[model samples]
Target: MNFIPFLIICPLTFLAGLVDSIAGGGGLISLPAFLLAGLPPHNALATNKLSSSIGTTASTVRYCKHGYFDKRLTVPSILCALIGSTCGAHLVLLTSDTVVKKLMLVVLPVVAVCVLTDKKEATQVAAFSHRKRMLIVCISAFLIGIYDGFYGPGTGTFLLLALTRLAHMDVRTASGNVKLINLSSNVAALFTFLFSGQVLFAPGLAGAAFCLAGHYIGSGMVMKNGTKIVRPIIIIVLILLFIKVISGN
Candidate 1:
């Protein structure tokens, strides 16, 4: 609503985009930036979606250009994510925030330990057949999309983990597919928020520019550095998520 708020929000949003493009959990930073800048919770969430969806689209394109996307899994994953997000968004209106936040608190420590202990190379080949992998990816997309639409702190990060571990994808391909899945879920959630007239276009669009710049640069880093860059960021994001949940924010 004012220049002062953008001053605070834009830079953090850029950082959010950067971290998000590389490892997911951008919302852990960006949403709080909005809240810190004095937007109401609903407006912050809606506007953050607008800015992030734009930024994510840029990174998704970059990943596609780098030939990291898996063509066979894209359509089914996107479809399931869309449906799941729609359901989650609706479900949120009926649910209590306390319930979800408490659930995340329980889940975060185990996730942190797993990520910390994982020592496998990022280039490992999948053990699952194509059909099985597709099934795993789609189911994960749908479930994570529901989370994204409802609570939405670490959707991208969760998707990345699921892709890498459960689907047995290489990190680069999993990262690329995670972007596609996140973008779809973001758009689905954005439209729901838009319909409710909650988005703040001025700040959202302003934030989008910074988000785009950050995401573009971060995606390049991912393309060049791959796992070396991805793992640490995921760890940082998980820590941030832990803090956010513990604080009940």
Candidate 2:
């Protein structure tokens, strides 16, 4: 119940939620904040999941309320994400962090270029058959869900990109779908940490309040501005991820 950790975590969590709500990669900020505040690594990761899960729920509801989510893809995507994330979590136990970090170093730049070079407008949906799109979406969701569970720095950004570029969804709809998928993964992880007693509820709850505020505002901005807001934030998140990987932090 230290005020110091609360002070450090809450503000950054707000910032993290804001960035995450818009373009993903909030953990690049929030997780580090928890560590900086002196939480042990396990507790920091656990508490981060707690706060982020709550904040993500708010964003997901907001996106769905705005009719940005695709009902047809919802159940399948969530199921795939759940299964993938569970597998990913287990995979992490067998994998080395160094391997993941090295892979990200190569992957992040390519992702950034794709986001930058993407000329598609927020409202422009790509042409793809419904069945084909469903296949693409579900597969992407499952694969990215595993990445979320295994490495998890920019899962939302990756999902957003996949939905937009691969599944041919518009930015608004893709963003919403990303939120839903991320929420499932986050909640799954949160429960694991919660059951294991790694979550620090006092700070986690406090951070959640701030995170909720951030998500509300950020998602509102995306709803208003669409791709103009999202693209830049995504680039920024990519840059942050790249730095984190290279620096090995």
Candidate 3:
């Protein structure tokens, strides 16, 4: 393995963390960087997960310390998301990426439009009772967890959108909670990749360190600026996902 690529992967991983920490689309950048560095698809994905899990852990801890994670929802969301992702991963073997990709291309634009237009609705919480809120969140987690597991280019963005629009979470709260859940999904995938001998630890560890730094900075930006920043980042990530899916890149 060439040692020179770390110079590139490290910075790119950090950038990915920054974007991902804010609104959830880090893999769109990091995975490409890994492949551009000449890692095979399997190695690139496995390594990317290691690096992202590091960044996400740091971000989630930051949010937890700041009192962003809702305990009532976090525990259930984690469990449901884990189980949902496992199911999605198993089902993926029987499904097709092209079909999913084409469908998302059509669906994402509509989601993006609704999210961009409704400033009030975006921040407003639903009128559900506490138990109902928990139920909705758990169900959303399972379904989106499955989606993340089956095809994950925009897992964070989708989670943010769902929670904000349906679960009545504010942008900042949604951003933070989604990070926690996304990390759960990443962990699920990483462990499998780890056992399969796919993760490239030397470079992945280096990327992880920088990714944590980026997550710190990005999460801070969201805290300070709130929806002003998170919304655009979410939109940008979605657009990037659209291109990525359509172009087959």
> Using TM-score as the measure, which candidate wins?
1
Q: What tens-digit string does per-residue lDDT give for candidate 2 at 1-249?
A: 677778777887887778666655566667666665767556666787788788778778878999998889998999998888777766654555556456656755664555445454564576788899899999998998887665465677778778987888988888888889998988776766666687898888888898888877876773654445556655565565456546645
| CA RMSD of all predictions | 4.3, 4.5, 4.8
Using all chains and alpha carbons, the TM-scores for the candidates as numbered come to 0.78, 0.75, 0.73
lDDT of every model, 2 decimals: 0.76, 0.73, 0.70
User: What is residue 171's positional error in candidate 1, in angstroms?
Assistant: 1.7
TM-score winner between candidates 2 and 3: 2
- Please give, for residues 1-249, the per-residue lDDT of candidate 1 as tens digits: 768989977887887778666655566667767766767556776788888888778778878999898989999999999988877767765555566456556654555454444443575675789999999999999999997776576677678778988899988888889989999998998898888787899989988888777777876773654546545654555566566556655
Tell me which residue pairs clash in candidate 1.
none
| Of candidates 3 and 1, the better by lDDT | 1
Q: Which regions of candidate 3 are displaced past 4 Å?
A: 21-24, 90-121, 217-249
Residue 123 in candidate 1, Cα distance off native in Å: 5.9
Q: Per-residue lDDT for 32-145 in model 3, tens only? A: 566556565567666877887787787778788898867778898999888887666556534454564465566556645544444433576667787877887788888988
Candidate 1 structure, TM-score to reference: 0.78
Best by lDDT: 1
Greater lDDT among 1 and 2 belongs to 1
Worst 10-residue stretch by lDDT in candidate 2? 111-120
